[model samples]
Target: MGYYTQAARDVWTLLIELQPQTGDSGGGISRDEYISQVARDIQSKLPEVFDLDVIRKKLGLEISPTSVVLLQELERFNKLTLRMIRSLAELQRALAGEVGMSSELDEVARALFNGQIPVIWRKLAPDTLKSLGNWMIHFKRRHEQYSSWVDEGEPCVMWLSGLHIPESYLTALVQATCRKNGWPLDHSTLYTQVTHYRSEDEVKERPGQGCFVSGLYLEGADWDIEKGCLVRSKPRVLVSQLPILKIIPIEARRLKLQNTLRTPVYTTSMRRNAMGVGLVFEADLFTTKHISHWVLQGVMYGGRAIDSFDRRILTVYMDEYLGDFIFDTFQPFHFFHSDSGGGISRDEYISQVARDIQSKLPEVFDLDVIHKKWGLEISPTSVYCYESWNALTNSPSG
Candidate 1:
């Protein structure tokens, strides 16, 4: 049968089997009452479906002859499902304001989803029920995690604004680098002691700045050919050092905006330069320069670098000017301006920039891929794609 037809049959079967009794309760079941009763029945039957033996043996656990859970419990006992569920549960509990952590429960969930628990637990062991109870508890926690991540939206701050490394590989890289450099590494210790440097001024003021630093200022370290190994630096260092992380490959794309449009001539910086005269003419006559500025800025921040002259112009525009003139002059075609002429608010702007970078940049930053290749889990969050923007924003050190 086709997927939709099969799905329809299954859903209809479930509704029929779990439908509310019609003999009592004001003669016939109201729609709302029927739905409520069906939900309650489903909840009651969940334990039977989650039975250990049934899951281990991969038996189809159906509520009725025609309907079964869409996904098999044992089949989803892998890393991706586990991580997704864990993230979901954690967020849910956090939003609920419940102190809902349980290490024992977590262990049982890991055993079940990771396929660590024995097959015999399905039938012979009393601990099987206990394991199921633990599974429920952990399942709740995972739900909380997922909910929290979703409500907050995209991660608090991506490592280098969506540099595409999974959290696991990033963590492992950090750990390995620390170990190599003889720097101490522990999640709790690092959490409390971390600091972020946004500019050279901060780095100068605090030269001993350790790992947890983030944002646009500090660059990563790289191998110095003359020094024979990786040596750390700033500004330029960030891009250079990325290759050493071995998370993702960085590639550069080049484009010329001037060729795309045609316009009249005006004045030129060099009186004899035709190209210069053409550009100046376009800028003066049609306000092309203003629109060009916004488009170029969008492209640059979106992770593509312009030519030398274009890059210089963009740097001046982004750094020298402090207001929304770039956005304003561009008007209706404000490519980078996300929030209309009222002006893109800070949060909105940041989110837009981050999303653009993430989408445009290559996925070389995934820590999980790095770890699987190198046998390490560098970042605590590396096993999954989700990151906590709240954690990053609330971090005192950053």
Candidate 2:
């Protein structure tokens, strides 16, 4: 007999023994009587580990595990008989090229040495695990041509996340490589796909055409254009078809202040500065009329009249204290009164302006060196104040 046929017969024998049996009071056991008897036996053994599903699958039976089966006077030995049947089936597969080391197989042998068989076996059913393991091993050893099937230009798509390389650099590199290889290059035909990373649970979709391509992903990092060095350890690649987005550089103005007063006094001043011309608001701030005016002055060097109280407070604090005294205490305080010509205390105004500025621009006022820089009369501050006031006055609605 063929090795496979012998294995199959062994498995079948084991299954037959596990089948439940029934007998009539008469000498001969009838099929219907046997089935009824087995059914009752199964019901009595309900909720036991001797599951019918496991038994059926092991025997390679066409019937469902839940289906009723008849056996003649052998119902009690079902579990033991089934196990024996499955073992013999496995032994047969092991002997044939269906399992184990076979000189005729190549792929199966490689798989066995590579430790993949154990992994597959662990996931398989108890009855099929051993045979499946041997089969895979045998197939690998006997099939040389089968192993190369994967190398036949099967399209492999890889998704990269956390890529930090710029799109331009990658596109340029690809273009350069194509030129060096004498490949026909189409710059206009470049296409890319992009997925924005938001959170761990968020799934990034594949990029479609017209998206940007940032860099060729190698290993876990984005490769540099010149030397192909990975810039970072994490595997991430940006795909964009458009020229890479350029980061706009911002120049921050630093001001130094000196405290000339024996007792530091609060000063207020209106700052009309156009500092945030190109910058967009990172977050929205809900300010009173006064605070809003100051914020606008800081951003556009102008005031919006939506909130007048906010504007008034901003104007008083910025012009008197922040722009003048706090910014440059060395310059003598020239104060004006509400009624017209009266000198106000530089110390009081400076303190008030400082407090106001702090409340409005908490981030800006949190600097340790601000006190030192505050006394330096810088051109930027002056320019900011001038622009703010001019913007306020020139407004048609103002």
CA RMSD per model (angstroms): 31.0, 30.6
> What lDDT tens digits, residue by residue, belong to model 1 across residues 96-135?
4564645643433333332233232332211222233454
What is candidate 2's TM-score against the reference? 0.16
RMSD of 1: 31.0
Report lDDT per candidate.
0.34, 0.32
Question: Which residue segments of model 2 deviate by more than 4 Å?
Answer: 1-102, 116-188, 191-195, 198-217, 220-398
How many pairs collide in each candidate, listed in order?
47, 73
Report lDDT (Cα) of residue 59, candidate 1. Answer: 33
